[model samples]
Target: MTSAHPTASRQRASAPHAKEHHMRKTVRTSIAAAAAAALLALTACGSSTDSSAPAADGPYTAPAKDITATISVSNWGDPGDKAVYDGVAKRFKEKYPNVTVNNNFTPITTWTEYVNKLVTQAAAGQAPDVINIATEGVELGMSNELFTPLDGFLKNDPEAASLRKDIDPKLLEGFSKDGSTYLMPNTFNTMVIYYNTKMFKAAGIERPSDDWTWDDFLAIAKKLTTGSGANKVYGFAMPYYSFGITPWLYSNGTSMMSADLQTAQLTDPKVKETLGWVRDLVTEHGVSPQPKGADPYQLFPAGKAAMTGAGHFVTGGFAKAGFSDYDILPWPKGTTKSTVFGAGAFAISKTSENPALSWEFIKMLTDQQTQKQWADAGAAVPSTKTAASTPEFLASPKHADEFYNSLSYAKPVAAPRAYNVLDPAFMRAMDEIMSGQDIGSSLEKAEKDVEEALQQ
Candidate 1:
């Protein structure tokens, strides 16, 4: 939820492009939520034009005096990235003093547009030596043959092996194509139920009791929900975007898409019934607010509202803003206790001047020590079980238990062949549904739109 989601494709929406409507907070995918959306699936295409040129692997023995070349690392630079990337470049510099990394950080101001510019750069033979690719950029870069596979170097190294083992493999699943590996794992933020304890005090609702049900949640939500017009404070906002809402339907065992990815299973009456509660929270019960105007991240942290949907990445933002008095709990259960799981990794360029050097960088990026730095800083939830359970984090970290507990019910985002095209329209559909439109009707439209897009 803290990642950036890309905002554009080669084919821009005829309407003025929008980055967040019903969308959850992403600095905008991996690099922002758009990048994550694109990363949801994998691609095999390598760089074209000078594509046949063999990989320039290197021994990369550290020069007696480390030569300094600023590594042009690209990332979908969002607020989350700024928080997470802290000391990463510093750590890399500490490890290799001569290596200067100047980040070409992609602004999540509007991620889709940002991604298209990135792909154009990649396709035009101008991608930076190191880039932060997520679901969005991966498809564009891989299909157009921009990224060089990291498989060869990583498979043979020991430090790199340890780093890989230290991180979660779910990230690999998010960034793989066919049978090949493309990215190295980085930080991950999963979806969790963000609640306002102050609201609990107001409503006399006990802090989320273990083993609460969806019905139990709704009952409490109604009590805390209040206001009318712009003054409204929603008890909860069913993640208005598909990334937040889809899993709920899926966890309740309602398929969002058909097996062939051709039809909208949410078109079923039962499916509509399931989502109806989410809508009713706003329209029927007046317990929730309609999603609007960027994301409410600052609001929750600022204590403007009671409950909002969020995950680990937002923890720092909350603390910095002084809304540190919060607790994370399971997303209330329906038929089952399901929550969305997400992860990230790093990738070395195949055409790098020093593949070995790149491998070393990858190792440093994924190393447990480095991972611990990021996690302890409150940038994100670490991928390793060991990191998550560490005393330094658990004994002091806020929302510690809720963040780890959600993993038991975590489900990775569903990405088909190419994921970049899948997210925008899906967001649009979710927006429509949350606006009190028919869930069945909107999902059907989404299916048609997605099918047409994938074929393109």
Candidate 2:
């Protein structure tokens, strides 16, 4: 469950802009310390490349209606997630009445912990037959030989083919490496700006347009900042993790790594400029809350902040907070309008004794009907085109479609094999720069750290 995007799985309790709660400091520290060891173990322990699995061939057909099997499906055990999976399980049962599907919900505090736990289960030979992996862990899972390739299944199954056609091709490609597909994408998330409509109206400011520029955003943010001390309302709150930061980097025409994910681009001039601009939002302009003291989720819903960044997962939280007077806007344009996105997919374990049953289960989970149910439940942005465009997903907040529109220019979160080691280092460097360290020196050090991690 390592997030396809950094921080994607960590739900902050009060954040209207996030779905999951925050990871404990202990978890972050443990992940940073154990990353290399975990990577080594992951590389050493599993068979990532299997040659004997059934190949996807001509049209795939399900086994006869009487076929019976039992398979365990593993996923993050969040209540919302469990509910979505429960619904999926219910529908899957209807299609295949005799199959015994065991839902194994593992409660985890962080993406790293989730990955570590899965690896442990895998090593202990207790891994679930079907596992949910995020984009962040897809490469790691593949490296460990943890999943069975779905290429054969996809090619041979008409249902899968139809489903694939509706899914974003980029998502499909993200789960595929060197011509093999490991995960069947279920849902995805994308970054967008969520602004409190009430705050904007109160400040006498216009709502942001889809094509709004960075300067436009800044001007509006400055106007929105008012109040004092405990009553002090900030204009914006920046997201502390890569999931939130990368959109700005991408929009500014820079990225943390090369497309191949093998080279660090932290020292690029555009990146340095982006970092400096972001820092100024806090230190110079005083428009955004400092990361250490701000609770944007609460602040935004309470009318203390004008804007924050998030994905679709935040909708439920915002509703629960009774903050209905808000809407989404596409991220303001820099060099271009861009955002970061990642997908979660169900992958069959290479070691599953019931591969056929597992495959069937995967198909059911990703089928159009289930995806539509996912959309209606507001669990995530559905992966299928038809489902994504359905009224169920597009109705809320009016601009929910921004998630889909942003996809045209969105980049997947970095998922290089070395990401486990590099992720913590990059986050530390970003934190340092944002806290007023010299940007050039901070990025230079981060560049060196990433290079060293790659070597390790």
Candidate 3:
């Protein structure tokens, strides 16, 4: 419930994005004008001929020292995020002293908004040389032709092999489409249940265990719910977002969509049953807060709630709220102990003026040292296996290893090209169900809507 640094793909619709929308519109116009002038210049010089030659297929060797060009990088503009990327830039500069790196901190709150802005920039031929894209936007970004394929660079560079060996292969595979990779996995996060230890002890209930069942979780939740109305302390807070909801679906051996990402599966028996169970937590048991837009991060750490689903990104926020007695447990089992997981990747733009240099910068960003720095800062779970196991990442949270272990059972978010439309529609259905609507009817309507959207 604490609002620490935001994690990759962990977007809340409640977060503001209106200001960013207007800003992007303004920037888009200017970028369009500049692009027009550049096109004219190229036409005048007779340099606008087709240059779609295939990239060389082999291991890429780093240039000795002749590279010198400014490269632009874009990422979410959070307060702490700049510091993390600044560290990466400094190290990148150490290797290429003359190459200037410009960081474009886009002030967007959600992956959807970020991808929308990137699409606008790309349309204007002004996308950054390198971009930090979250898993939710990877498919969309690739479909827009905004990113250069990284497979050629990966196959040609020996260092790329070592880098691949360090990072999680599943993370890499998630960003690939049709056997071509468009991004290098940088950091990842997985869903987990964070419980208020103080509240559990006060309620005379034992803390959750790794293999606890959903029935056990609900029982504990009922015991932990106390007080009344405005002064009430709830047992659990259900996140209305997909990151939280998908874990329940996965644990029950179902998903919001088919594994092929081509069909909506909200009407599946297991999915509907899972939704009904979650709805019961709010209506029948009265152990969860009603979806009235209260921030769970603030509520949980304030001891207004006993448990909530979250990722490691909340750790910093919990520390800031002066609530340090909390501990994490794998989400209670349903049919299986599964969780939703996502990762962030650094992708090169197809219009990059210096693809080789951009690739080099990406290499530095995902290297073992940079991954360790990010982990030590508690920014995100390192994508690299070596960095993930290092002392820096394992120091604070006694059970931090659970995050890594959960990856074995974790499912990549389903991101079909229609995700931009499908996600919001599904979220609406979930909200309706949680608000006391009939689950069967709501899910049926949601399924039709998603199927229609996917066809468009």
Residue 152's C-alpha lDDT in candidate 1? 56
Worst 10 residues of 3 by lDDT: 1-10
lDDT of 3 by residue, 80-175 (tens): 566667888888888888888877665533434454555555555555777776666565566555567887788778888889887777888888
Name the weakest run of 10 consecutive residues (lDDT summed) in model 1.
Answer: 6-15
Q: What is the C-alpha RMSD of each candidate to the true structure, in Å?
A: 6.3, 3.5, 6.1
lDDT of 1: 0.56
TM-score for each predicted model, relative to the true structure: 0.76, 0.88, 0.84
The pairs that clash in candidate 3 are: 1-296, 1-297, 1-298, 2-297, 58-156, 59-156, 60-156, 60-157
lDDT of 2 by residue, 1-456 (tens): 224343233232445434343352224322422432343343445444433346655455666767787778876636666776788888778877998888867554554556576568558656577877677656656766667788878888766778888888878887887899888888777878989888888777877677999999999989988888898888897766666788889999889889888888889999999988888899899999887556556677777788988777667666666668889998898998888887777888776777767888888778887787667765467788888898877888977787677778777887666666667777788889877888889888888988887666
Least well predicted 10-residue stretch by lDDT in candidate 2 = 24-33
Best-matching candidate per lDDT? 2
Residue 118, candidate 2: C-alpha displacement in angstroms: 3.1
User: What is the total number of backbone clashes in candidate 3?
Assistant: 8
Off by over 4 Å in 1: 1-72, 78-102, 110-124, 135-155, 177-180, 226-233, 258-271, 293-295, 298-305, 350-353, 385-387, 390-392, 395-399, 417-420
**CA lDDT scores, all candidates in order:** 0.56, 0.72, 0.69
**Candidate number of the best TM-score:** 2
